[model samples]
Target: MGSNPTLSVFLNHMFQENSYEKIIQTAILTAYPRIFTDIPLSKEIFDELERIRKTESHGEITAELKVSKLAPELEARYKLVDQLLHKNNATQILEIAAGLSPRGVEWTKNPAIEYVEVELSEMARDKNKIFKALIETPPNLQLKEGNALNLKDLQKSITHFKKDRPIAVVNEGLLRYLNFDEKAIVAENVRALLKIFGGVWITPDITLQKLLQVQNKTTMPGKNQEIIQRTGRNIEKNSFKNEEEAEKFFNNLGFTVERHSLLEVIDKLTSSKKLNISQKEVKKMLEPAVVFVMKLEDSRA
Candidate 1:
């Protein structure tokens, strides 16, 4: 396989239970039904996932365990995203930092919707190949190769987008790893994109919550783990201390922002799934991986 360092960096961020939930979530919400199709994971992807279940290829131990929760995990995300799309009547899905996900293919089933998937140059090519080979994602579902930090690169891709309808952008599982300067620029670029193409979409985590697993502690490789593990690039999250700081900063950028905890969002999703688990367990899980889905008060904001 080709080397994709930025994709690699984001993937490591989700290499734990708290982190991996976002992976399960984005995959389910964006790709699940649209890409895999036929429910319960079509034969091929299911088999691949089954193989992954028995192998060490997925990630660390916690990641594997998190993968085991796929059904409920996916269910939780799908439940929320569908509601969001329905409530907002969005016409397109724009997923950034959307590293290696099946959602692009999954959501293509909706004739009215289109997906604009953006990623690092290396991953965009590989993912485009995997996604294109799996199924025809429609002229609507398009993939672009570029750097997330580079607006010109992102806009080159966006320029091709048929922006005649409402759009939803999922900055899921992003933000925490960016340095303050990079974060400011990216958030601004995204805001500019939203303003340029008006509509409501959600980017849940803004406080840039640090990954923490309670009770049982598993050491997940942090951002620079790749480099520390080998002679790799040292990319890490230069973060703000709390949600207030993130909001205060993001608000100044001109978008009307709202912040919610992972607990609040998960409870909403879990209730939709009707999963049986004590508040204690929920609390435990949310402590490490809290989720929040925000609606842009004004896409133009």
Candidate 2:
């Protein structure tokens, strides 16, 4: 338990009173609309997001300012998830720890896709109200109260979806908050889900301690520090020792894993004008990020 003065100082400044809920709030309410304007739901949710920001983080950084600072990195991560989702033909998506993300709201626009978003109790209740308020609520979209670590609740939550169709379980910004044991439990729960439906688990939640340590060595990597300190947790100790260990960890949990470089999609995003960040800047932000696509070995062809 040694202290790294660099990370400590940066964390204190950037994430003074942040938490997992606050981070999710920033992404869905702030970053989504501000950066990913091409998506229709992103534009539609602006007023609602403003209301949430006023109530959720009042007197803190305004949603616009916070998202502008986080725009490039956050948009890149979302693109990674969107890319991976398109890789599978699964018509059904079950997003865990869904927060207020507009993925379900947006994707349900296509009648073929059944998007189920699950969050813990209070968050689920609030989002349900908003989803209901929309003029055209997609019949295929659902918001439920479920915990990632609770197998029974997860099992019950997905009952509305067709039993025979495959399901892609998507999670982001959830695992880093969990300890090894908690992660393992979530893995088990996801494994069970795949066992039944036969699809993959898509996540960008895995982190490498080395990459973060490298970032901390630099003078102005406050974004990395904000991610770590927001949870009020020591992420270095929770993160994988290396990428190899991460693959092995999931492999032992019965997954056949594919690792995707989060930075690889930056060029596509920037070229499309969805991301205003430069290549040099995007490279720096992607230092500690990666996306993992986990399929049950048996599900693989």
Winning candidate number (TM-score) = 2
Which structure among the candidates has the greatest lDDT? 2
Candidate 2 all-Cα RMSD: 6.9
Each model's lDDT comes to 0.51, 0.69
Worst 10 residues of 2 by lDDT: 1-10
* Candidate 2 per-residue C-alpha lDDT over 58-162 given as tens digits, one digit per residue, 9 for 90 to 100: 444353334443445455677789889998776899999977667787678799998888887767876766666654667898888876767787888888777
Query: What's the TM-score of each model vs. the native?
Result: 0.64, 0.79
Model 2 stretches astray by more than 4 angstroms = 1-39, 43-46, 52-67, 133-135, 210-230, 270-276
Which residue pairs in candidate 2 collide? none
